[model samples]
Target: MNSFFARKYVIQGIFISVAILIIARLFYLQIIDDSYLLSANNNVLRKVIVYPARGVILDRNGEVLVQNEPVYDLIVTPREAKDIDTLLLCNLINIDTVGFRKRMDKARAQSPYRASIFEKQLSSRTYAKLQEHLYKFRGFYVQNRTVRSYPDSMAAQFLGYILEVNDRDIERSKGFYKAGDYIGASGVESSYEELLRGNRGVKNLMVDALNRPKGIFSEGKYDTLAVSGDGLVSSLDKDLQILAERLMKNKIGSVVAIEPSSGEILSFVSSPSYDPNLMVGRERGNNYMKLLNDPHKPMFDRPIQASYPPGSVFKVVAALTAQQAGVIDQHSTFMCPGYYSYGGGRARMRCTHVHGTTSLVHSIEGSCNTYYGHVYARMIDSRGMSGPKAYDLWREGIMKFGIGQKLGIDLPGEKPGLIPTSDFYTKRYGSTKWRSGYNISLSIGQGEMGITPLQMANIMAIVANRGFYYRPHLIKGIGEKKIVKEEFTEKIYAGVDTKYYESVIEGMSRVVNQPGGTGYSVRINGIEMCGKTGTVQNPHGENHAVFFAFAPRENPKIAIAVFVENAGYGGTWAGPIASMLVEKHLKDTITIPKYIQDRIFNANLLPAVKVAAPKAKDAAKVAANTTAGLPKSRIPSTLRINADFSPRVNEDNARVNPLIEFNSQVYE
Candidate 1:
């Protein structure tokens, strides 16, 4: 009886302890933790996301290039919506009844209790109309958002475009972005996305049974304000960009102009470009499809994407490299008897004229292929070096001018371009069989060499700075502080000594200033412009006209490169365009004759557009059409050269100025 009583007391003690613990836990949750209460009142609470305004983009002069315009998204909670007039709601949001049902089904699929976007990017008029009758709808509300707006409607490729975030974009953002969020897809929009897209905030509100917002939940304790994104001051010059676009209007090519001292890109133009505004609003997808289908390829960003042979413009790099290697000097003479003979006279590279004894400067001015051929031969074979070793060293020297590699510009889709390595030659032509003569076309900037307009322009900047250059960039400042990144400010040397640039500069100067120089026709009267003209050979069609220049000679301000596709000579098209840009930037006016401006403005070099779309089987044929018969590795896959388009020059104007004449004998 005593043992039984002791066991009973122990069991009673355990029961009493458990009851007390349970009561204490309930008391703590009810009195201290309000989170449980919030969960219990979930039916009455609502969470709303507040989106911040996207950053504005300004030109270097503080002119607004891109800004935000407000729009609305119609959101709905399917469970809360009951016995509503579906047709009226659809009419208010400018959607059909069928569309409304599909959206409702989609919302229910997402979460019946949670709100989702029913319709997005509502215009101001629609939002105003919907706001008056929104009380009639139980579960629908409007959420404010902003879309990008380009006021000037220019720089389609540079400014880029934004689209709704995909699954990949959301995953990459690490839960920061969800469905229905917009993200930058290309160009500066993509490059500075984080700074341009500001922080999003949230607000908790109390709602009635009708789903109408009553007031802030817990008296605004859970509310957070949205912070607008920081504005960006771009390096682009609005006027210059506009002029470049105008000049490139009917042509097919690209232009890249940079400020030599700061490496700020002033003007970037890719011809056959569409207005940036087309990439905005509800019509964006349709417009994008049209642009994508257009044969001219307005969507391709040529400045950083299209890689063409540098042509005679590359001779400047050859000259510097030859000087550094001690193969040539200011007075070094090469005999050019109309052509350069190599492979024991089996191969001949023709020249424009028979320059009997051409000096280093004269070689550049005249663009004598024979002079460079001899100089390159000596540089490759002399000094008791093997051809492969010498060639690799030559490539290294050329790459220092920002060639054969991406200059790390503040843009997307930059290609490093093609500069074949000695290993590449070895793979193609066996180890010991390939000699300097096998790839001598490299001396004149052709055959396996490719360069984008951006890199070419940067090369001019290197020369303008006398063998040093800052990395080319598009942004000048970020936020109100106007902070420039350290990478953009750092000076990168081109690996050539300063002394080597004088003779090259003199040759370039003569190319513009002297009568016999190739670029003499396009020389500005007052400004001492140093420029080189290049007529790049194209196997598919007419040669590409190319020019690179820096102006005022001393303390140069602007450096530029221009390429005109299917145009016969650089002096006729590319040189004039570059000179005009220089004049406009420095003098802020066009002092050149009206004929010069008219020639570029009126010229139509665009290829004929195909009326019928290519079939599925013919797609490969269409893609290969531009670079037919050329090796895929040699050129950019997207590079489109018009095989049949002939450049039509005004014969009347050509006769008026003998310097503007396109001479068949003159080939670079």
Candidate 2:
């Protein structure tokens, strides 16, 4: 009996030890190790990202410039897409089986179990057809999203466009963005991307054994709400913008208009602009390729990006600086026998016209190079310092007018424009080798000096405001509350005496209204318009036509600048356009001569560089390759206009908008 009891106790001890070991193993599986739990959860749960709608952009007059349109994206999960009807699926999305397989293979390389976009930007009709048969394909689902659409074909450069996020964008987003997500690429879209993109949401979902979504997990216990993006009220005037586009059509330069009082951009036009719509939807890649390959560079934002010699416009700066420096005054006179002879009368700077004796006012009105040449020399020699020291002071005074620096306009890709310092000349010519005579071209706004059209417009605004200006910007307010930033509203003063602006304004006013003024042909009948014209010297081609102006001398409302590349004298092409644009904006109608309007409208000033469009066969190949899911109805025309506003088709077949697209819904 003793022996039997000892064996029984041993057996009981063995049983108790086995029970504790089992309990410990269960605890390790349930709590200590997370890998198994994570794997199990991955197989049973799905996290869906909810993208929010981008903001709508509107003109100051409440006309929609940019809005959102619903587009469908076909998403697929490789793990659950087994046994799909490959042929039927390909036919449904308008793709070949080989293309479909290639897309799937590429997606699988990215991730096998993760969901990715298989086809993007399906039209509404395609979406309708695909939605019905989506259930047939187990792992494929249709997601409704929005893409940007332009209501009117205007402001292509400054309005900008959106593009798919790449690896770099994903890394910069701190996990906010992933592959297939869209982000603003340039222009206002890029500058205000945060306010325009809004917040994304996430929804936790339960999945079946096959990795198909069953329903919302725990009745959306962890789901977040997607907030719609804020809306932007821009300072652009739709009517003025349309008119500017019409005037600049077929040209190769830029037009910039500003409101003097508010410093709001009224119209910004870069000619050879592609239709903003062309950069949207599935064809963006091909359209972008065409624009990029074009030699004229329609994608290049000329208003803020192209820096040219300010030409005679810099004479305005020269006059202002000279008066402020006490080097020259309104009564100061210089004799111009059609040129200024310097370097012991060996080197001469020629003037276009011979004004016997030119004063400050007459120098501007007649655009005499000799008068400014003398004034610039005097200013450089005013202070009893070295040429470099005086040049530094002169540059400082010029920069106060917002030249040689970024104007801080709310746009991307703005060139600061070159305003060379004393050191620049010193380095180029060496410390002791150069003098004022060597750089005399700068007196007439040539040589190393460069300025953008927008900066030129800002200079006009400063003159109109009498030494004060607001930073030029695109946005006026944001969201429903109409909130405007204080920085945009604050007045920035150019450090020049208010007393001197009148003399400059008087000279500019004579430039348009006076009988002998160079800009007399562009004068309006009933308006007191102040203006200046410039012929930028271009060594490679014809001179560029440039002009800037403001209207109604008392309490000026509008200020503008126009630059026409390789278009000859400013008074010929740029002056009329700038004056008519002013009339259209201020009076809402253009009463300018019909012959003048027609001449501008019919001119084509593009360089020899033309972008060749893809051939019919090549376009067909692109259609087959890039647009996998989009139907034939959604594909844009293969033969389209290039950057110079020249068409690939006959003039009869060329697409044209009416002269006016504003104040009428029919324009849409």
Summarize candidate 2's per-residue lDDT along 540-641 as a digit string, tens digits. 656688898988888898999999998888899999999889998878888889999999988888766534667766866665676677776665444231
lDDT tens readout by residue for model 1, 466-551? 98999999999999999999999999998889999999999899999998788888889899999999877666667788999999
Tell me the lDDT of model 2 at 209: 43
For model 2, state the Cα shift of residue 220 in Å: 3.3
Clashes of each: 0, 0
Indicate the worst ten consecutive residues by lDDT in candidate 2.
659-668
- Note the residue pairs that clash in candidate 2: none
| RMSD for each of the candidates | 9.6, 11.3
